[model samples]
Target: MTEAPPDRRRAGISILSKLLAMLLGVSLLSALVAGIVGYRNGTDSLRAAAIERMIEVRESRAREIEAYMDSLRHTIILDSRGIAAQAIPELHDAFRELDEEPVPASEQAAVRDYYEQTFVPELEGRQGGEADVGALLPTSDAAWHLQASYTAADPDWDVRLATNDAGDGSAWSAANAKYHDFFRETVEQKGYEDILLLDDEGNVVYSAYKGVDLGTNVLTGPHSGGALQDVFEQAERATSVDTMAISDLERYTPSEGRPTLFAASPVGSGGQASGVLVYQVPMDEIDGIMTSGGAWEKTGLGRTGETYLVGPDHLMRSVSRGLLEDPEEYRDQVVANGTPRETADRQVAVTGSVLLQPVESFAVDESLRGRSGTGVSTDYRGHETLGAWMPLDIPGLQWVLVAELDTSEAFEPVRDFTRNLLISVAVLVLLVSLASLLLAQVFVRPVRHLVSGVREVAAGNLDARVAATSRDEFGELAGAFNEMARSLRTKADLLDEQQGEYERLLHTLMPEAVARRYQDGEETIAESHSDVTVVYAEIVGLDDLTRDMSSDEELETVNLLVRGFDEAAERLGVEKVRTLRSGYLASCGLVVPRVDSARRSVEFVREMQRVVAAFDAQHDAALRLRAGLDTGTVTSGLVGRQNVVYDLWGDAVNLAFSLPRANDRPGVFVSAAVHDRLRDQYSFREAGTVESGTGGSSTGPEPVWELEEDSRG
Candidate 1:
C-alpha cells in the first residue's frame, strides 16, 4: 500500500471501515430476515392455535347444551308417564266438582282485585306493556275458588307460593292438598321454573307454584294463543309418551315475562293420552352451561373471552358474561353497538341479556345458516374477535353457540413475541461482530437455564426451579417464573379443597343414595312404595310456648326438639321426611323399604312422645305431642331447588295427618290400616272415626284407633 494522507485515506474509505461496513450490513441483513421469518411463523401458529382452541371450546359447550336438552326431553317423557297419568283422573274429578260448587261473589272479587293490584301490574312490568286485568281473571268457578284460596288468600303468596294448602275445606283444596306436594317437589327438584298439568281440553288443571296460570284454560283463556297453549295442543295430539313438544324460549307473562322455555309430553294411561305435562325449563341452567358458572377462565376462556347462545331472532338466549363481570362496561359497550340505551339499561336492570341483547354479527348469521367454522369477525359488542360458531343440535331450537375472544387478547402473546424478537434482533445486530463469543457465554447460558425451567413448568412440573445464580434480568425472570408456578400450585390446591367442601355439603344435605343420584345428574327423585308407614307428629304447645320467647330462644327450643326427634327416629329406623313449624313428618320404608314398617313407625312415634314428655317436665312447659301412624301405599322423594327436603304424599300421609286432629285430646292414634297391621303385636282401642272421602281412597267413615298406654313390641 502507498503512503497516503489521512484526509485522502478517509475519503477513499479505509479498509478497516470497509470491513466494518460489510460486517454490519451482513449482521443487520441476517437479523432482519430471521426476525421477519420468525414473526410470521409465530403469529401464524398462534392464530391457528387460538382458532383451534375456540373451536374446541365451542364444540364442547354445544355438546353439553345439546345433552342438557336431551336430558330435559328424557325427564319430561319420564315425568309425564309418572304421576301425570295417575293424578289426572282424580284431579279432573276434583276440578269438576269444584266447578259445580258455587263461588262466592266476595271471593271472585278478591281474585279480580288480586289480578288488578298484584298480577297484571307485575306482568306489565316484566313484559313491558299494558295488560288487561279482566282478560286474565279466572273465568271458571273452580279457577275462581282455587285462585281465591291458594293464590289470593295467602299473605305471603309472592314469597312462599309453592305452599299447597289453604285450609279452606273445598273439594279442589282437598285435591290440591293430596297432589300439590308431588308437583311442587317435582318443580323444585327438577329445576323447573314451574310445572303445569293440562287436561285434553287445554284446561290448565293444576299449577305447581300456584301462579296466575293455575286454573286458566289455555285454549280459551287470556293466554290461549301463546306458547303454553301451542305446546299443550301439540302434546295433547301426541300418541305416545315419547312424543313431546318443546317451545322456543320466549317472554312468558305468567313467569313475569322472564325468557321461558316449555317442554311438554303427553300424559297417558291404558293407552289413552288424557293430558299434557308441561315443564318450564329454568334459565339459570342454560346460562350456567354457557358461562360455566361464571368461571370463564377455568374453561380456557381468558379475559375478554366468552361463549353465548343466539336464538333465531338474533337475540341472546344465554346471559352474556360481560353483563355479569362488568355491568357498567357492558352497558356502555352494548349501548354503543347499536343496542338502544333503554334496551341496554333494561337488560342491566334485569341482570339478564337473554332475548334482549341483539347480536347482528357475521358469526350468528353463519351459524343460523347451519355452517360452522372459525374466523375473525365483529362481535355483539362491536369488538373484532376470533370466534368459533356452531348451530346447536337441540330439536325445536334454532339456537347457535358462538365462542369468541377479543382479538386484542387472542393476539397478545404474538405481539409480545414480536416485540421481544425485535429487541433481540437489534441487540444481535449491534453486538454480532464484537465480543460475539463472550456474549454467548454470558447471556446464552442463563437464557438456556431459564428456558429449561420454563419448559419444566409448562410440562406441569411446578416444583421445577432454576437457581438465580446472578442478580441479572434473566435471574430475576427465573425468580418471577418460579413464583408464578408456586402461585398456580396454591390456587390448584384451593380449588380442590373448595370442590371437596362442596361435595361434603352436598352429602350432608341429601341422603347418600339421593346425593349420589344428584352427582350422577339425576334431577328429580320421586318414587312410589306399595307398602309403607308414615307417622305425623304435632308438637301442640311449641308454637304457643315460643310466642313469648325471642326469635333466638324460639329457634333454640325448636332445634332442641327437632334434634331429639331426629336422633330418636334415626335410632328406630324411621326416616324423618320434614318439619313444618311444630309438626314433624317421618316414615319407614320411604327411602329404604322395610317389611316391619308399621311397627317401626309406631315405635318412632312413642319415642317422639317421650322426647316431648322429657321437655315438658324439664322446662315445666306444656309441650304435648300427638302423633298419628298409618300404613299404606305412598309416594316419597326429595323436593325443593335450593333447600331440598324429603316429602311423602298419598292417602297414607293424608290419613296419618288427619288422625291426630280427629279428636280433641293429644294422644297417639293409628289409622285403621295401621291398627290392623299392629293389633296382634300391640294393644289398640277404637279412637274415633274421621270422614275419609275428602281426598283419600276411602269413601266412607274410617275408624281411628289409639295405641294403648302399655303397648309394646
Candidate 2:
C-alpha cells in the first residue's frame, strides 16, 4: 500500500498491460480457430446432404419418366392390335378410288395456300428461318383431295380434329368420318399430341389432328429422313404385338417446330403387320414431371433447384424451371453463360428451353457413359451447383436426368453459422455445438429412417413406408420412396396379370401338358398315343350363308358358331386342337388315354351338329354339319416358334379329315376303326369308302360308316 517511484510504477503498469494483451490474443486465436473448423466441417456436411437429396430426387424422377414411357408404349401396342386389319384394306381402297375422282383447281389452290401461308409462317416463327412449303405439299391427286378435306377445310386449328367431313362427297372423306372420332378421342384421352395411321405402302391414310403430314407417304415424303419416318419404318418391320419403336426428341416442323417425341407400332392381326400406328408425345407431360408442376419447393427442390433431361446431343429435352418461373433472369444468365443472345431470346420467346439449351459438363458426360452418381459441377445456367445425374432407363432413347441445386443456397446454413460464430466470440463453442446437433437431426435421422424403410421394402415388404415427419428435403425423399414402392407393387401385380394372360394363351395354343413342356424349355414337343380318336368337323354351307353379309357380320356369325362348338366340346370332355376357317379338329384320349375315346369323339361330333342346327334355325338359313371320326395311332405336337400351333397327324387323323370330304352328303361319318370300337354302343351303316387323296396308297379304300338317325345315347 505504499506509493512507489514514478519509473517503477510505469514499469509495473506496462507489465499489467502486457498481461492483458496476451490474454486478449489467446481469446481471439481460440475464436478464430473454432470458426474456421466449424465452417469447414459444416459446409462439407451440408454439401454431402444436398448431393444425397439430389440423387434421391434424380432417381425418383428417372423412374417416373421410364414408367411414363412404358405406359405410352403399352397403350400404343394394345391399340395397334387388330386396329387396322379391316380399316387398312378399306382405307386403301378408298384412297385409290379418290385418285379417279378429280379435285377442282380451287381445292388444289386452298391446300397449297394452307402450307404456304398458315403452316410455313408459324413454322418459321418457331424455327427462326424459312421452310420449304413446296416440299410439304401433297404430290398425288388422292393426297390432294384428302388434305383439302381434312387439313385445309378446317380453318380453326383447335376444331380441326372435330371436323370429320369437309362437305366434299369423297370416299376418303366418308371413311374419315367413320373413324375420325375414335382416333380423336384416343388422342385426347391418352394425352397424345396427335395420332397418325399409315397404310402398308406408307401412305398417311388418317391423321387425328389433320396436320400437314397427313395424306403424304411417310416413307418418301419431305419429312422422310426425320425421326418420325425412322420410327415409322422401324414399326412397320415389327411382326408381333409387343414389338415397337421410339424416336428421340426432335423439333417437328408440322407441329410448328415444337419439341416432339414419336412412338410407333405395327397395326394388324393374325401374325401380319399391315400398317404403322404413330403417336406424337406431348412435350408438356415430360416437362410437368421434371418441373414438379412448378411447385419446386413442395418437392424439396428449393429455389434455384431444378430437374431436367438431356438427350444424346447434350441438348435439354425438358423445360427449364428458370425459364418457366423467371424468363428474363434465365435469358440473361444463359446469355452471359456463353449462349448466343439470339438463342436465349428464342428460348424466352417460345417460353421453353427444350432443344435450345445445351448442358456440357462432367455430370452429363458421365451419365452418357452409363454412370450414375453425384458431383459438383457447373450447371446449364453456368452457376456452381451440386448435381446428381443418371442415364434414363427408357428404351430406344439415349437420355439422362439431372437434378441440381445452386451452391449458394445449399451452403447458406454453413455461412450463417460462420457469420454468427464470428459476430459473438463469447458464444463460439455453444453455436458450433448447436449447429452440429441441428444438422444431425435434420439430415442423419431422416436418412436412417429412409434406409430402414428401403431395407424393409427390399426384403419383400412393399407396404413399408417412412414417416414424412417434416416438410423438408428429407420428407420429400420419404414420399418419393413410398411412391417408388407403390409403383413396384403395381408393377408386380401387373406382372402377375401378364403371367396369367401368358398362361391362358399358352393353354389356348396347346394342351396343358404340352404347354408345361414348352415352358420347361423343351425344343421339340411331341406325344404318341396309339388308342386316341380324332374328330374333324366342318360347318357345311357357311360360306354360302355368309355370301351376302358384310365382313364384320360374317366374322360375328363365325365367332358365334365357333364359340358354341367350343362350349360343347368342353362339356363333352373333348380336347380342341385347332379351328380352321370353317373346320374344327378335336381329340379325346390323346392326353389322357380312355377306353371310350371313339365314343367321346362320336359324342363331340353329335354336339357340334346340334350347335350348327341351332345356328341355322336362328338365322333362318340352310346350313349342314359334316363330320368324321377315326381311331388309330396318332402323333400330336406343337409347331413353329413365334406363331405356334398344335396339331395331330397319322393315318387316323388323315382319314378323319378326308372321310367328311369323301362323302358328298352332309352327316356324321366314321372310319372302320372307329366303327369297330363304337358299333356296340351306336348303330352304324356302311356309307361308302374314303380313298386316300395320295392315290398311290398300297391300302385300298377304307370303308366309311354313317350313324343311324337316333345316334345320341
Candidate 3:
C-alpha cells in the first residue's frame, strides 16, 4: 500500500477480531466437555437399567416355574383327596340305598311287577338271574310266573355269598348281581383300569381283568417283577409308610420299545397292607405334561428353556421343552449314560437338597450337595448355558427338576441394545456439536450488527436500522430490535400523549401475573381457586343427532356444543377440563375446592340442564345429560405442547365421571357420597338406591343413590 492505515481503524479491527476469536474458542471447549459428560452418564445409566431389567426377568421366570409346579401338586392332591373322601363314600352310599327289604306275599306280587318293569330290562345282556328268580316269584300269581320263567341263572354265586351274608340264597344272589353291576358301571365307567381285591400275602382274589384269577399271586406276576418286589415288601412292612412305589423304565423296557412310568400305592386297612393299587402311565403321556408348551410358553419362556425331572438314580423320567420335541432319545443319550444311580442317590440322601446346575460329564461330587439355591455357569455340549435347578418333593422319590436356558440366546437382546445405544449416543453428540457451532457463528455475526446499530443510534443517528438478511429466528429478532429502536426514537417526541393508550392495550392483552411471567421468559399455566362444585356431564342424544347430520356437520355441531358448555362452565367459575363431542365427557371443580363437591356437582348439572333445555327449546328437540360427581382432592395443570390446555386428575375427577351414569335418572345420576355431600346444600329429591357399575364391592354390585332436582321448588 502507498499510505499507512489510520490508527483508530487499526485499533477497532484488532479489538473486535480478538474478542470474536476468544468467544468461539471458549464456546467450543464448553460444548465438548458437556457433550462428553452427558454421553458417558447416559450410557452408564442405560447399562445399569438394562442389567436390572434382565435380573427381574430371570427372577420372574423362576417364580413362575415354582408357582406352576406348586399348582400342579395342589391340583393332583385335591383330585386324590376327592376320590378318597367324597367319591368313594358316595359310591358306598349308592349300594346301601338299593332296596333289600323282604315283602309280604300280597305286596310281593306288586314287587315282582315293579322289578320286571324297572330292573328286568336293564339286566338283559347281563347275568342270567337263575338263583333268585324262582324264589322271589309269587307262586299264586299268574303274572309273577311269567316274570320268573324269563330270568336267567346267576353266573357268580360263590363270590356273592363271600362278600356279603345278609339274605336268603335268592335275595343274596340278587344283591350280588346288583353289586357286580354297580362295581362295573360306576368304577370302571369312570376309567379305573383294574379294581382288584388282594389278600395280605399280595394274592389277587378278585380282579376286573379276568385273566388274572383268584389264586394268582401278584408278587410273582410281571407287574410286580424284579426290584419292584423290594418296594412292595417295604410298603407292606412299614405300616406308617404311605410312600408311592416308583420304578425305572429301563427295568421294564420290552424288546419292542422304551420303558414306561409305573407307580403303585398300597391300600392299607386297619393298619395292614390289604393290596397295592398299581397305576401305569405310559412314558409318552407323562412326557406330554413334562414338555407342554402351554405351561411354559405362557410365562414368556422360550423353546430353548427346558424343564426335566431327574430321578434319584440320575435318570430322566420326564422332560418338557414347551415345544413339540421327543425327549426320549435325549434322555437316553444325555441322562442315562451321564451319571451313576448310586452316586446320585447318596448325594440326595446325605444332603436332601435338589440339584440344579449345568454339567459337562455329570460327575457326582460334594459340589452337587446342599439345599440352598445357587446358579452355575458351565458348558453343555460346548455351549455356555444358564441352568436353574429345583428339587421336586415327590413322596417316595428324590428327584430334581432342572430348567436350562442357552445364555447367548437369552441375553442377545440386551447385548444388541447396549451396542446400539453406544453408537446412537456418539452420533447424536457429533450432530449436536456441529449444529451448536454453526448456530453460534450465525448468532454472533447478527449480534455484532445490532451492537453497532445501537451505538450509531445513541450518537443521535435516528435513521440507523439493523439489516436482518435472513428470515430465521435470529433474523426476526434482529428486525424486531431494529423496529423497537426506531419506535423508541419517535416515542421520545410523543411519550406523554401515548402512555394511556399503551397501558390500556397491555391490560387488555394479558393480566398482571401473566405479563410478569412473559417479561421474565417464564412459561406459566393459569390457575384458579374457589369453593365451587365441579361436575362431569355427558350428552346422551348424540347418536341420534349424528344419524340426522352429515359427518362434517356432526363434527361442527359437536365442537360448537363443547364450546358452549365450556363457556357456561367458565361463567360459573368452574374449570372445563376436557370435552369429547361424541362421548360428551366434561369436567369441573378442578381449579378450586368446594364446601361440598356433590352440591357443586349438582349446580354444574343444573347449569348444564338449563343450557341443554334452552338449546332444545330453540330447536324443538329433546336432549338428555348424564352427570357424575365426587368431592375430593384434585390437581389441575396444563398438558401438551402444541395445543396446550388445562387438565384435571384425581379420584374426584373419576367419581364425577362415574356418578351421572349411576344416577340413571334420564337427566343426571350421583353417587351416594356425592348425594351425602350435597343433600343439605341443594334441594334434591331422592330416587332411592340403584346398582351402579362404579364404586362398589370388588365382586358385588355397587350401591348408588339416585337424585333429581325440583325445578319449580
Candidate 4:
C-alpha cells in the first residue's frame, strides 16, 4: 500500500517542537537507565570482590587454627612420650617435703569417716560417676581443715571429717614447690592453662596448679567424669600408638571451675598404658587468630565484620568479638536472651574462655551440617549479617569457619556509591538535554551517517566505517564508534575461545548430560541408574616410586596415574568419578545405559592394571594397580558447592572401596554380585567376607571373589 505525502503547511513548527520533546525524553530515560545499570554493576562487582577476600581471610585464619590445634595435640603426645611420663616412680622424690608421718589420732578418725560417708556416696558405687562438690571444689587451707569445703551451714558436716591435711606440708603444696616452675613453663610457653598427669589408675599424680584436684582419683573421687578420667578411658581404648584421645572444651571442677580440654596419649614404653598426659587447652592463641584476622578495615568489612569458628557441638571455638571487646554489652545481651540471673552471673565470671557458649546462628548451624554457602542471615547475637561459611578439612575435627559483616555496615559503601551515581546522572541528564536540543538542529547529516554505520555494524559488517567529513566533535564521535566496533570484534573472538575452554573443563568434571543439566540452572543434579558397575582402584607401591622425589614430583606422579585412568575410562565407556588420596573411582552405565556395564568395568580394570604396570616398567619402578568391582543400582550427584564435584553414592560404591583395602595383594577383587554376572567370561577365586567394621558382619567372606583377568586378551 502506498502512503500519503506530508502537508508543507503543517511541517516546520510542528517538526521542530516534536524533535525538542523527543531529545529531552530520550535524554532523561537513557540517563536514568545508565545510572541504575552502572550502580548495580559496580555494587555487585565490588561486593563479589569483597566477599572473595573475606573467604580468603577466613580460610587463612582457619589454617592457623587447624595448625594450632594440631600443635596442641602434638604437645600432649610429646609430653606423654617424654621422660616425665617414663619416670613415674622418680616423681615421688619431688614431694619429699611432705612428711610421711601418720595423721593425728583425733583428725584421722574424722577423715576416715568423711571418706566413707561424705565423698563416697556421690559415686553410687559406679566406676564412672562424678562427685558433686556443691558449687566448686575448695582447696583452701581453711576448707581443708574439714578435708572439704566448710560452709557456716556445714560447720559440723566436717566435724566428723577432721583433716589429715592440717598438719602442714601438703602433697600438692610440696609438689608445686618442686615442679611449679616446670609446669608453669608448659602453660606459659605452650599456651595451655593447666596440665595434668594421671596415673595408670586415673589418679591425678601431678598437676600444674595446687588450687584444684591433686590427690583425687578420677575413677572414685571428686574428679570422676572429669578431664583426667575421660582422658584415661580414651587412652585405654586406643588400640594403637598413632591415635590420641581428645576432648572438646567443657567445664571441669578439677580445673578450678574453668573451661578446659584434655588430649591424652598413652605413656610408658612398649606395653600397656601407664598414664595419660592431659593438656588444659588455652584459648588465647585461638582467640588471637579469630579476632585479630579481620581488623584490616581496608577490605570494606567495616566495624561489624569479623571471622570465627564453630565446632560440631554448635559452640564457638573462639571467643565472640563482642564478648572480648565489650563484656558488659555481651552480659546484657545474654541476660536479655532469657539466661537466668544466677546462670548468667556464673557464665560471664567463668573466665579464660567462651568456648562452650552455644551458637544460635543459622549460618553456623547450617555450616555444621556440612552445607557451605553465603547469604544474609540473623547471627547469634541477633544482628542481621552477611555471611559465608564452610567446613574445614582438618582430620578428626568437625569445624566450620564463618565470616560475617552486619548488613548496615556491609552495604554502607554501596549506598554511598549509588547516591553519587544518581547525582552525577541527574546533572548529566540536564546537560545532555540542552546539548541534544542544540545539536539536533546542526547534526542531522552526521546523525544519518552514524545511524547508517551502526546499522551496517549490527548486520555483522566489521569493515563498516564512517567518514570524518567534518573535523569536529561529530568526527571524533565517529572515530570513537569505529574503535569500539574493532574492540568488540576482538573481544567476541576471545569470548568464543574462552567458552570452548570452559565447556571442555566442565565436561571433564561431570558427564556431558550432567553438565548440561547443571548449566541449565538445576539446583540438584542427580540421576539414578540400574545395573551399573563401580570400580575402586588404588595404585600400589606409590611410596617406593615417589620415596626419593620432591613433593611436586610426587604429586606429578599421582596426577600421571590419574590421567591414565581417565583416558582408559574414556575408551571403555566408563565415567571417572573422583580421586581421593591414592584411591580413584569410576563407573559404567552412569550417564548412558548399557547391557554389559559389568563386562566394560572389568575390562577397564584390566586396562588400568596394564597402565600402571607399563608405568612401572618404563620408570624402573614397582607400581601396581588393584581394583574392586561391584554391580548394583546407584545414585550420583554433586556433593559440594565451593569445591563442587560429581560424586557417586550407594552400597555398590562403598563395597567396592572396602574390597580394595580388604585384599592386601594388588589384584582385582569383586563382590559375588559382580562375580555372578561376569563368571561366564572370567575366572575367579573366593577371597573373604566383607566385614562392615560396625560389629555386625554380613555378605559372607565366601561371596567376595578375586578376578584373574589377562589384559593381553
Poorest 10 consecutive residues of model 2 by lDDT?
8-17
Residue 420 CA error for candidate 4 (Å)?
A: 2.5
Q: How would you encode candidate 2's per-residue C-alpha lDDT over 1-713 as one tens digit per residue?
A: 78865664433444434554555566567877876787788778876777778888898898889999989988888888755456666788888898777889988999998888788888898788878888778877778888787788765766898887877787777878887778888888888899988888888888888888877877787667788888888887776857779999988877888988999988888877878888899998999899888889888789889999999998999999999888999998988888889989999999988889988888999999999988878987899988889999888999999998898887677677767766776675456555545544454342776888989988999888888887888788888998999998999899999989999998988889999998899868888889888999888898998899999999999899889988987887888999887898989998888888888788888888888888878989788889988888899998787776788988888889888876688999998888888788898888988785344564778889999869655
Candidate 3 per-residue lDDT over residues 1-713, each given as its tens digit: 48966666433444435555566566556656765676577666754553444344445544554454354334323333323222222322322232233334644454455445533433331222222433323322212221222221122323322333223344323433444454344334434333433344654333333221222344764234643455446545655424455544443311111243434455544455444544333444444445453455554445455555565554455533421344333333333535344433332322211131124423211123423133435432333445555554444445555555556655655556566666765676566556655665565463665778878888877678888987888689789978887897788658756766665654433444443454465555545433334466777786786787898988876776676776666666555555666444444444344454455456656777777777778767667777765555555545555654446655556656655555445666665566666666554555444333335433333345555556321
**How far off is model 3, as Cα RMSD?**
15.3
Worst lDDT run of 10 residues, candidate 1, spans 437-446
| lDDT ranking, high to low | 1, 2, 4, 3
lDDT for each candidate structure: 0.84, 0.84, 0.48, 0.69
Give the range where candidate 3 is weakest over 10 consecutive residues by summed lDDT: 145-154
lDDT of 4 by residue, 321-426 (tens): 6665666676677667654555445445543225545667778888888887887887766678888888876655677899888878777767788888988998
TM-score of 1: 0.60
lDDT of 1 at 488: 77
Q: Name the candidate that leads on TM-score.
A: 1
Q: What are the RMSDs of all candidates, in order?
A: 22.7, 29.4, 15.3, 19.7
Candidate 3 wrong stretches, greater than 4 Å: 1-199, 203-218, 226-231, 241-265, 277-297, 302-304, 312-315, 322-383, 393-395, 432-620, 624-713
Sort the candidates on TM-score, descending order: 1, 2, 4, 3
Candidate with the larger TM-score of 1 and 4: 1
Global fold similarity of model 4 (TM-score) = 0.50
For candidate 3, the per-residue lDDT at 633 reads 55
Model 3 whole-model lDDT (C-alpha atoms): 0.48
